[model samples]
Target chain A: MIQNVTLVGAGNVAWHLGAALEDAGLVVDVVYSRNYSNAKALAERLYDAVPTDSLDFSESKSELFILMVSDNVVQQVAEEMTLPSSGAIVVHTSGAVPLEALANAGLYVGVFYPLQTFSKGKKVDFSKISICIDSKSERILDMLAEMAYKLSKKVYHLNSEERRKLHVAAVFACNFTNHMMTIAQEVMESNGMHFEMLEPLVRETVDKAFAIGPDKSQTGPAIRGDSKTIGKHLEELDGKARYQEIYKLVSESIAGIEKE
Target chain B: MIQNVTLVGAGNVAWHLGAALEDAGLVVDVVYSRNYSNAKALAERLYDAVPTDSLDFSESKSELFILMVSDNVVQQVAEEMTLPSSGAIVVHTSGAVPLEALANAGLYVGVFYPLQTFSKGKKVDFSKISICIDSKSERILDMLAEMAYKLSKKVYHLNSEERRKLHVAAVFACNFTNHMMTIAQEVMESNGMHFEMLEPLVRETVDKAFAIGPDKSQTGPAIRGDSKTIGKHLEELDGKARYQEIYKLVSESIAGIEKE
Candidate 1:
């Protein structure tokens, strides 16, 4: 039952968490960022939030401070932040940084990482998003779990080591996967074909991968041992050396795994 | 109205397309495959479908013949099958093959490539699937359109070249993308982590990709220009030379694209 909150940073993560927290019955009283206009822009969206560029929270009444800054700046901002008057539970929404990064910043420090890709102006369904929370203190962990359970049904209590692994895995599963799609889009658009034509196929790929395990759900020439189709594809990508390299490496990797 | 369909090659494509066509009120009368058991297994699910290992269709009263064989065998089977008594429209469900492959085999020939992956046991929703149709004759194209439109709202009349481009793009988008997920799954599972933990992140990645274009939706350490995080990931993957190569290459490619 955290009543008031202070959200740090005005980027995609901050904007999303600020709105979701407010909608979930918590009051986001202050929005802070180094840039004044950005702080004002995000703060304006909340019910009665005040905007400030200063890091001082000495006069604020917010019981929870969420640091939604970039991974590089999380530790710096947490150390520079002037703790609130209320012995507030300060947390960062980063999957990479450990909870010890905020050890000296506040009495009760924790990590509340929302496992979703947030782009500004895009509406995210918080209910479907998973939240990974961690804290050293039992009392803070219980509080973190309660606040997280309000936003999503999926909440995992992962430690620093586990969270880092999760982050690395995400780098492969989500970030790398999206890059593959981007490469496909660039290739198709350059060849005078509509990239959207592959929409149904892309959706079906993801649906199948999750419906069955990725190992069982794999399709295409690489797995089927059809080198003819693979040869045609490689020939097509020959002009683009980078795409050709990726295609060759990944295809050979797939064929290699099948042999095992 | 294409009333009766004589489905050839009772594989994954035939198992799905046959049931979908039957459910759309078209009758599937005969299913032929090199293997009699596979034909029987699929044909038994349809209404009044006769399973046979022979390729002859001279005695069958079918109006449409669909070849659902592999890409390598599609053209060969198209040339080998005996023409049915009713002079049916012969089509192959292959993205790689051209419509002219069936030119000497039947009076009416076309392509009815359903643009989705299919497994024998998995249930597929045909309405969401896209069907790509092509034919030299307007009459055959119209008949193909009539039947395709009944099963799905998305029906594209892409020529052979465009269809080939589509197949190539699918290799990058669907096939390669799923492989990325598979790699991530292997990495996670080998490390004593549950692969399903990445489900929410994967779903969100796809949702964001299609909602906005993939270029704008791309988010990660590489895209964010966070080389330190990328370095950490590479270090984690250093033991697996193949994975390390993939990580370094894809990340460098993403960084290169951003510079461009």
Candidate 2:
């Protein structure tokens, strides 16, 4: 049962997680960021959270310290931070980084990776988000799981490798899907069509994909093996080599999946 | 003020469109399908629609004839169908086939394309769908627009070429996005992870993509040019050459997009 917490980094994930934690009756003791103003802004939103640029935690007695910084800086920040040897659990909110990245931080380390995309000004409902947690000790895992359950109903005890694989899957699902949408928007905008016209279709595609597994719900010229339509689409994207390449590759992949 | 209509074909599109037309108070006078049972099943759901296997519309007196057949057979059906020469408007509900495909139908021809992904047994709300209409004559366009407005608030007067372009974009936005989701699901399933864990992320990805244009909202290792993480992901997809290829190409494309 973690009662008090300290947040490191004041970016999108940190801001949202900090707010959710505070709302769940946890006291946020401090928020540390290289950009002091960012830390100050985020800290202002929580109860009795002091914003500071310092890495020293000797003066505070928070039960948990969460490193919510970027992937490149997590290990560095973890190495530099000084925490109590035995009492507080240190965790980083990253899907890509392994628990070993914080192993040398001289504290009981764990991962509290929330598997969801965060936007700065948007308020996220944590209940719908999956929180992936892993720790070296059973006691620490239980404590982290309890804390995670307070914020999210969907909590998983994923190890480092599983969490990393999940992150890769997320890249394909969320990141690649968004890129496909960008290509669609470009195609519409180039032809003097409004992007909003594709919104309903977009929503239906996602809904159908989830309802009946994406493989089974696959449609269009590619899966139909209609080379004529594929040719026409390629012709439509003649000058844009990048777009053509992506279309050809993905379409062929879909065709391959269908063949299997 | 188009009211009485006859539908040709009884697939997913025909099923949904026929229901929406009937619910909007339009008389579906007849339905024709090569598969008599399909036509009969659909026609039974509508108001006073007679099911027939014959292409001949000589016995029917509907004001409008809508060809809701597949793209390969749209022209063939149009060339064979017999309709009232002067008053009845002949149209096809196709995004890929042009207005010219209906030119030889020997009537006032037009397009009544509803830009949406239709699945069998799924009842879609017509109000949110966009209906794209086009015709050679002002009178026919006005009548089609009026009928379309009955089913959808979002109606666009796109010409054949523009509609075809929109269809291509739909392939990317809807079909390709769904394929990316398929890959994600495959990754998760292979790793013994439940697909539902990805649902919220998928929803948020679409929401963010729409809120801020997908190109601007794009995030991930690829856009960030984090070569180390990209390398790790590529290595992770080792044996699956197809997945590896797609991941590399899309990541490179995203990196390229970021450069520009």
| Residue lDDT tens for model 2, B62-161 | 9999898878889999898877644688899888888998878866899999988888856788899989999989999999999999999999999988
Model 2 over residues A1-260: C-alpha lDDT tens digits?
89989999999888899999988889999999999999999999888999999998986789899999989889999999988655678899998898999988865899999999888756788988999999989999999999999998999999999998899999999999999999999999999998889999999888888888888888888998988889888988889898899899999999999788
| Quality class of the docking in candidate 1, CAPRI style | medium
Q: lDDT tens string, model 1, B1-260?
A: 78998999888899889988988999999999999999999889999999999888888888989999989988889888987676888999888887777778777999999988886567889898889999999999999999999999999998988787778788888888888888888877877778888888888888888778788888889888998788887877767888888888888888888898
Candidate 2, residue B82: the lDDT equals 78
Give the per-prediction TM-score of chain B: 0.96, 0.97
- All candidates: TM-score of chain A: 0.96, 0.97
TM-score of each: 0.95, 0.96
User: Which DockQ value does candidate 2 get?
Assistant: 0.80
- The 10-residue segment of model 2 chain B with minimum total lDDT is B80-89
Model 1: per-residue Cα lDDT at residue A51: 92
Error of 1 at A58 (Å): 2.5
Cα RMSD to the true fold for all candidates:
1.8, 1.6
List the pairs of residues colliding in candidate 1: none
Candidate 1 Cα misplacement greater than 4 A, ranges = none
Runs of candidate 2 with Cα error greater than 4 angstroms are none
